[model samples]
Target: MPQMIFVNLPVTDLDRSTAFYEAVGATKNPRFSDDTASGMVITDAIHVMLLTHDKWRQFTDRQIPDAKISAQVMLCLSHDSRESVDQVVARAGTAGGRIDPNPVQDYGFMYGRSYADPDGHIWEVMWMDAAAAEAGPEAFAAEAAAT
Candidate 1:
């Protein structure tokens, strides 16, 4: 059987978090979700478990870091094209997310942007040209050096 992965994130508001994930294109699985937690599907193999602060505490003894002030983990996802990357970021902002101050990366062959969700969880959307990526590091170096 193929293995699946679930990333559990502590959220201050379960309802809000669930709504945010839905807005960002995740489908909720009712089987593993309840009043205190939500299971958001990112793909067939990956899922995100949004747990309320109280529910989160039951799984871990460490304190949950304030996402607004602390950086614990950043989740990045790939898009099919550069425009798709921009579209998702814009949608995130419209849905109450904060676009990170980090500059957009345009390597001629790749592009991406980062943003913080309502809970301040960092998420990055990126795109890479398959042909360019397959060309290797030397191609990247040459392109950057020429700029």
Candidate 2:
């Protein structure tokens, strides 16, 4: 079986968070979702577990920092193209997320943008040319300079 990743996030409003995720293209996996938590499937290998503060406490004793004020981690996902990256960020904004919380990144062969969820967790969407990536940054830079 292929390895999978489950990213767990503490949400202030479970329903709102779930809706926002849905608007950003994640589908709720009802099998593992309930009143206090939701399982949002981003892809076959990427799942996001949105948990209420109370539910999050059950897993850890550490205090939950306000994501709106402080960032604990920045999550990123890659897309097939730059347009796909922009589309997701736009959807996130329409769903009440803070668009471009971080500055955008654009290299000749790569591009990225970011958005903050309603609860203030930042997620970055990026795209890179497969050939450029396979050839590595040094090779791409050399080719760009030659051109």
Candidate 3:
């Protein structure tokens, strides 16, 4: 079986958070969801578990940081192309997410943008040229300089 990742996040409003994730291209996996939590599937290997504050406490005793004011972590998702990165960020904005909470990154061979969900969890969407990435930065720079 392939490895998979599930990112659990505390949400102020489960319904709103679920809707926001859906708008950003994640589908709800009802099989792993309940009133206190929703399993949002971003891809076959990537899942986001949106948990209510009460539900989140069950997993840990630590206090939940207000993501809007204090960031605990920033998640990132990679896209096939720069356009796809932009599209996801736009959809996030339309779904009431704060667009570009982090400054945009645009290297010739790579690009990235970020958005903060309604609950203020930041998600960065990025894209990189496969060949250039595989070649490493130094090699890519050498090639670019020659061209």
Please give each candidate's TM-score. 0.92, 0.97, 0.96
Ranking by lDDT: 2, 3, 1
Per-residue alpha-carbon lDDT of candidate 3 for residues 1-147, written as tens digits (9 for 90 to 100) = 899999999999999999999999999999999999999999999999999999999999999999999999999999999999999999999999999999999878889999999999999999999988998878878888999
Candidate no. 1 TM-score = 0.92
Query: In candidate 1, how many Å is residue 81 off?
Result: 0.4
Clash-forming residue pairs, model 1: none
Q: All models: lDDT?
A: 0.88, 0.97, 0.96
Off by over 4 Å in 1: 143-147
Shift of residue 125 alpha carbon in model 1, Å = 0.7
Clashes of 2: 0
Please provide, for model 2 over 41-142, each residue's C-alpha lDDT reduced to its tens digit, 9 standing for 90 to 100. Answer: 999999999999999999999999999999999999999999999999999999999999999999878999999999999999999999999999889889
- At residue 90, candidate 3 shows an lDDT of 98
Off by over 4 Å in 2: none
lDDT of 1 by residue, 79-110 (tens): 99998898888888888888864578887788
Q: At residue 13, what lDDT does model 3 achieve?
A: 97
Q: Estimate the overall C-alpha local distance difference test score of candidate 2.
A: 0.97
